[model samples]
Target chain A: MQRATLNRMTPYAFMAPAAIVMVIALLYPLLYMVWGSFRDWNPAQTIGETEFVGFKNYITLFYDPAFRESLSVTLRFAVIVVSVEMVIGVGLALLLDRNIRGMSVLRTLFILPMMIAPVVVGLMWRYMYHPTVGTFNRWLKSIGLEGVDWLGQNALMSVIIADIWQWTPFIFILALAALQSLPRSALEAARIDGATPWQQIWHIKIPLMMPVLIVTCLLRLIDAFKVLEVILVMTEGGPGLSTEILALRISRTATEFRELGVAAAMSNYLLILLLILTAAMFAYTKIQEAREARIRAAAEEDM
Target chain B: MPTIRLDNLVKRYGAVEVLHGIDLSMEENEFTVLVGPSGCGKSTTLRMIAGLETVSDGEIYINDKPVSHLEPKERDLAMVFQDYALYPHMNVAKNMSFALRLERRPKAEIDQKVREVAEVLGLTPYLHRKPGELSGGQRQRVAMGRALTRDSATFLFDEPLSNLDAKLRGQMRAELALMRQRVHKNMIYVTHDQIEAMTLADRIVVMHGGYIQQQGTPEELFKRPVNKFVAGFLGTPPMNFLDADIVERDGTVWVTGKGFELALDGEHADAVRAHRAKQITVGIRPSDLSFDPDAANENSFELRVIVSEYIGAQSVLMCDCGGQQVVVELKSETPIPLGETLRFSVNPAGVHLFDKESENAI
Candidate 1:
């Protein structure tokens, strides 16, 4: 009995260090944030001195128009940037997945943008999108065209374009890897089955690549929701909250507005949203695995 | 059915040419099997015909129409890959109907054709299952069903049965032969297995080192191989070759080796009289060596038996003649003790002589 109990506890003993680290580094802060979300506490006062105000901060932020505007802006930015990046990235991968001279060098160059620091990417795009004295305006003037306001009137569009330019390579590299690992004989069989190049991609390649593309899209979506550095460096949420994503709002709420309790509440809300999205993805994979297991069982039974 | 013709087909990758110009033609409903060892350019030639590989030079014709530049889909051909190559995402029915669906055939017609082919292939019960859920033999049947549903003018198989187990390969080979009888199309198959080539091919094209060594009916190639490679490649207990010299002893042409001297008569005698090569190689099939205790010493070989491999009803004896190894097939019931020198008479008709320098049958 003692040996059996020790064997059962062996795995837990091995995982003890990681579990302790996760509790101290991750779960404690999450619990603290959730605990503080219901209080009317100021940053200057200790938590024991604060008054217990249940759900007031959460209720206040729920009806706040600026918070609602910031949330909408974040949702819009994430959806648009993620969709555009997915299309351009997967398209580039399909186009470049071949054996040609200098293809490795070309692929390396294509992924260079994703390697740069986010702040540097923001600075680089800010200069390029400058109204008068930058690359775009200079090129426009060279072509005898009047300069247009890039970051001022089109702040959201400028930030989105910058984010896409810096991040599309993330999807490109992954999609290219998935495309390369597909079965070569299946493609040949499709060719022999009278499928044109476009039909082959539509009927075989894309269906086979769906799982990878889905996971990549979800990862990019989660990253897009929490993006802050590039927009902070580029626009600082100016032009009336045009480029203010949820992460920026959370930062501004804590630091500038001096509402630590409200900020924690907002952080908890964002965490919940992310948790739901992650759970959905997990459920999808679980269902897929179950279906595959059932099919394998059927095959074994027949054999 | 279209008569497919390959006129001087060649394949080259950069400066290295793998397939020399190969010229061949297939009749309307003939089954042509290309048999060769690895790197013999058999697969390259098949891929060139299937348009999976580009032709470096030469022209391909289907019913007298040039199709060298056409894509695989445009050639009206269906291919069964060695791996079976069934689409994992599609069910058996959908896989069988893929070509018809791509051609925009009527849905009812596609369904009917798919059902007919699936029934014929004994895949009716698994029509709704994906390729991953089927056994290897079942997947192979689905691949064949897919090819049959296309009803293309030509079918190309690249070692389809090479991936199966020995027993399953035999079963599938028999099924393929039965299908060949029922489906009369221009079929070109490639394999390195000599037994498959002998069993299934209406015409066997033997290749070596990117060149056609010989091509003829299975019996013709087996009985009368043009060169040493084909002779040694296309037999089970391969033909035994011995270094010998042809000489005219007392107005009778004879081949004299280290431990045996065999007199040539009939066509071989006439050919030896006209031939000028003194040093030659004598080829004899293992089945042609018969034990004859009272045979003359000049017409018989005294070999020391080393090992006996008993394979069911027949047994093969590994013997040493002078210094060369020879294999002989005999009935397993023959009482022959090991480690004993025995006399085995050579059949006159089975004595094949080739020029030593050229290794070409004389």
Candidate 2:
């Protein structure tokens, strides 16, 4: 009986180190943030010294137009960046999924942007988007055209473009992998079945790649919401609150505004939004698996 | 139905040529099967006809019009793939009507065509089920249904029944034969299995090493194969080859081997006398050997039975003549003890002789 009990405990014994690490590295900080959100906390004072203010910070953030604007900006950025990236990335994948010479080199070149550090990407784009000395402005001048404002009035668009530039390859690589793994014979059959190239892509390739594309979109959306470094480095929420995303707002609130409690409250709101998205992603996969299981069951019943 | 012709078609991957100049034509409503071992370029030829593979040289003509540069859609053909290749996202009905929908046909017409084909393929009950929700046989039927709804002049099949289990394959093969009779169109089928080729093909083109070895009716290919490869490839249990020498003994010509000597029939004797080659290979089918105790010594082989495999009505016995292996298919009811020397007489009409050097039928 004791040996059986020990065998049952073996799995838990193996899991103890990971559980401890999770509690220390993840659970503790989350609980501390939740605990801090209710109180009027400062960076200098200990948690116990701060007076509890119970939903004051949450109420303030909820009503703040600046906070609302930042939230809207983050949503807009994520939606635009993700949609454009998905289209261009999936299109590139479809175009490049072939056995042409030097394709491996081209594929590697496409993914080069994703390999660069976000700070470096930000600095690179910042220089390229410069008013007079920048690549785009100089090229425009050389072409005898007026230089357009990339960062001044169109700061949000500029930041969104930078994010898209660095992240499109992530989607491209995944879409290419999914496209490559699709049934080759089915595509050949579709060709014989009187589908042109565009029709095949629209009807066969896109529908079959929907699952992987959906998952990639959600993952990119999650990453998009928490994006701060590049935008912060490039725009710095300058000229107004145009490019001030929620993550940048949360950081600026805690460090510059000296409002730790409000930052914690904002973090909780972001966490809630991300939690919903993560739950949706998980649910999507679960529903897909259930559907496949049901299909297998139905097929087996026929047999 | 439009007749399809491949005029000296060639396929090359870089410098390595996989399909040599292949010149063949199919009659309207004819079921031509390209059958061979794997990597023999049968599938490549079918794909070239379907316009999925580019023609390296020569031209493909459909209805006497050059179609080499035409797209698969423009070529007016439908194909059923080996893996069924049913779209996992679409239901059986949707898959069947995909071509019609792409053509922007009337919705009612598409639905009617899909329903008719579905019913014919017995896939009406599973019309709303996706490919993932169907069994292998049902998926195969859906694939066939998809091709049938297209109403293309030519239909290409790349080993369509190969992915099914043995029992299911036989069932599907019978259904296919039934369907073939119902839907008379120009069809080109590719398979590595000779049995499928023999059963379904009106004309079977046997390929070897990217070259067309022989093309004829199944009876002609089976009875009088042009070469040794086709003889050994087409039949079940395969033809047994033995090294032998042709010599004139008295007035009769005899093919003398290690453990047996067979007197050539009248027709074979004339060929043997006219032929300059002294050494030849003797070919005999397992079914041609029968136990004959009172047969002449020259006509019978005293083979030592090594293994007797009991397969229901027929027991295929593996026998040894000298050092070479010779198989005999006999009724299981025949009491043949193992390791015993038995005199099995060769049917004179079933005898096949090939030149040893060229391996060509003499």
Candidate 2 RMSD to the correct structure: 2.6
- The weakest ten consecutive residues by lDDT in model 1 chain A span A294-303
Worst 10 residues of 1 chain B by lDDT: B124-133
Stretches of candidate 1 off by over 4 Å are: A1-11, A46-51, A282-303
Per-residue lDDT tens digits of candidate 1, residues A87-194? 999999999999999999999999999999999998998899888788988999999998878889889988999999999999999999999999999999999998
Candidate 2 residue-wise lDDT, A1-303, digit = tens: 999999999999999999999999999999999999999988999999999999999999999999999999999999999999999999999999999999999999999999999999999999999999999899999999999798999889999999999999999999999999999888887888778889889989998998899889989999999999999899997659999999999999999988899999999999999899889888988998789668756864764
**Worst-scoring 10-residue span by lDDT in model 2 chain B:** B124-133
Tell me model 2's lDDT, rounded to 2 decimals: 0.92
Q: lDDT per residue, candidate 1, B67-91, as tens digits?
A: 9899999999999999998988887
The pairs that clash in candidate 1 are none
CAPRI class assigned to model 1 = medium
CA displacement after TM-score superposition, residue B327 of candidate 2 (Å): 0.4
lDDT of 1 at A165: 91
